[model samples]
Target: NDWHTAIIPNWLKTIYAEDPFFQKTATVYTIHNLAYQGIFGWRILEIAGIDEYGFLYPEIAELANVVDLMARGILFADVITTVSERYAQEILTPEYGEKLDPILRDRKDRLFGILNGIDTEELNPATDPYLAANFDVSSLDRRVENKLDLQRKANMPPNPDVPLLGMISRLTDQKGFDLVGQVIDPLLRLFDVQFVLLGTGDPHYHAMFRRVAEEYPDKTGIFLTFNAELAQKIYGGSDMFLMPSRFEPCGLGQMIAMRYGSVPVVRETGGLADTVKDFDPRTGEGNGFTFKQYDPWAFFGAIIRAVETWKHRDVWRKLQIRGMTQDFSWDRSARKYIEVYFKALEFRAAETVGGSRP
Candidate 1:
């Protein structure tokens, strides 16, 4: 799906170029994250046996002396796709392109963005074994028991009225920890909410959150280790799920959060933009709270909106039910993927009939 298997397209286009069976095969290259392209020195191309092709895009200066496997995949694949519709568009711009915008733009017509889906059976709140109490949209009242269980596990007093915000991600700038660091102190000071964080990453954030936990022991629950059971508890317990990422390709967290009845509060970019619509009080239409700009205040503003919305119990329950009831299953996404596969096959058929590679 990413750089690790990107070279398969290169091998198909070059090493197996003349083979009748391989010629009929169409490759669909999917980019999960563009930032981690498998780039190496030019000499390594000989080892891959594609040295005869030299560089895929020598016109692009940065790629002149390197073998970028991901670029090769993009150049050779019949169809290119990313995780979400928004990310497919974002990667065409310089801001989010990760130096591959030119090639991506050239192949824009072949590019497709399909929003990812979660495993409904495994993540279903009604069936999750990890949660203290299993509850669906209909039995949402029973969900509070899980909050109390999570509070006890995190060593905090169980308060049903206080909103509990949950975050499960690596502690890094990409995940929007920088914005969190900036607004967390004020958020804790200004609001009567409890924040629970799970997952570990950058040492700086680890140290930062450790201090946050130390300073606000009563209001913060920090676990710097990965625990699958604890993760399910956080999803089932928290009232709001936070995912203010700098750029998310396609976030499964927000979908999983919604499935578990945790309303998402996320930055409007990539999959987060496509999935989590901003909550509107008047119409009550959205599944979550979202901010567009990457500024700390913008993120804080979205959080405040969620916090305010939580005050209205009936409206909040409706929002939760709206999110929980919506489908984010593989059935829809699998159909889209089948379409992409057919489109890829069409491209290959056209090339074969025309006697020219597209």
Candidate 2:
């Protein structure tokens, strides 16, 4: 399948150029992650049926003695889109583009970012079949019962008053496990909080969390593995969800957490910035907690604020309700997708008539 990557794009280009019927159709390419661009050696050109001279084309040659499938797709496709609006802009910058910044900047006008939506119904805490107790914004008492059940399951003592934080993510440097590993034990010692972490990645984090669990058995529950049902339970049961990602293109965890009435504590970068807003004490407006910097102090400060907000039962309840009411379903995102499709068609029509890209 990986070998097909060398052949498919060129084959498609041949089909579009030779077949009038196919030429009339519009092509749209999406960049889900700019970091993984399928960069292979120059030999791939032979597999793509391109001679040495053909590989010397400006578009192919610019990717540095190697061939990049993603770059070729961008050069050939009618329109290019990313998963999030912020990420779309981010990719045009040298910091996040992974050496495709110039290509992305040149095609900025054709680049679109459509924030991906979640399955609200599937993530709804009230209707999630996996939860031990299902409840909605109206029945938060039952929601607390689920928390107690989760605590018992994690063997972290059933105490509904203490703030319980949950995380279901890959424990890697990109996910900010570097900072998390440093601050967790200290945070647990200082606050009356419990954490349920579920994930499996990077032996360093696995050992780090295991050490933390051994030190603070009652306060931390670390599951170094993946379990979908357990993930849903954490979403439904926890008071807050944590995602301190260094750079998130578009995070599904924050959206899903809000859907389940769990406030998100995330670092402000990419989609996390777009979705999670800092709490305004003057107006009490934001849904979740967010920190601007990637520093450990900033992350911990956001947690402190969230824990402080948790102390005020009335304020915490209102914040929970506000989060639960947020709507990030597929309907809006699908409409944007359709709009991009039409734009791609228009670009294709323009290119066909003029025999060049706009």
Candidate 3:
């Protein structure tokens, strides 16, 4: 779905260009993340046996002497898509394009965006064996047992009144760890909240979070290793799920957390923006808490709002129920993909009849 399989489009357009069966074959390239483009030295083109075609876009100076497989996939594929609609639009700009904006803009007409969906059957909280207690929207009161269980496992005090925030992500600046590092100390000191973090990443973040754990032993839980069971526990147990990504292609974590009855607190960017609507207290609508700017104070402000909202027990329960009931299944995303596939075939048909690339 990303850089690894990106070269297939190049090979199909080059090696199989004249093959009768391949001539009618249309390729659809899906970009899960744009940051990790499969870039290599120009000599790699000879190894790929597409040296005759050389660099596809020599006019773009940055790609003129390099073999960028992702670019080739975008350029040669009949259709291109990203994991989320917002990311597809974001990648067309220089900020999130990873130096591929020119090429992506060139193929913008053929590009589409379809959000990735979680398997609802597998992620169902009601059927999850990993959770300490199983509950759905109808029986959300039963969800508190999971929070107590998670607290005991993390060696923290089991207080149902304290708001527990859970995070399962790669500890990196891109995931908004920089923002977390900036505001976590004040957040812990000023608020009556608890934080539980899972997943492993950069050594810098590991040391930083370790300091947090040591400083706020009573309120913080840090698990530096990945455990699928623990991940589910965090999802089902935590009062709020944190995903402050600077840019997310299509984050499944927020969706899964909501499915598990954990209200999401996310940064408004990419898929996070598409899926998480800012909660309006006046209207009593929307799914989660969101902040737009990629600033520490902005993130801290959102967390404060979530904590304040938690004070009103009835309001909090309604928020959790609202998040839990939303449909994030693959059915909707599957239909969009089917539309993109048909669009790819139409492009292929047009190319064949017109004897020109679409």
- What is the lDDT of every predicted structure here? 0.92, 0.83, 0.89
- What TM-score does candidate 2 get on C-alpha atoms? 0.94
lDDT of 3 by residue, 177-293 (tens): 999999999999988899999989999999999999999998989999999999999999999999999999999999999999999999999999998998999999888899999
Residue-pair clashes per candidate: 0, 0, 0
Q: What tens-digit string does per-residue lDDT give for candidate 1 at 199-258?
A: 999999999999999999999999999999999999999999999999999999999999
- Show the colliding residue pairs in model 2: none
Clashing pairs in 3: none
Q: For residues 222-250, could you state the per-residue lDDT of candidate 2 as single tens digits?
A: 89999998899899899999999988988
lDDT of 3: 0.89
**What is candidate 1's local distance difference test score?**
0.92
After superposition, candidate 2 runs with Cα above 4 Å error: 1-15, 51-54, 57-65
- State the TM-score for model 3: 0.97
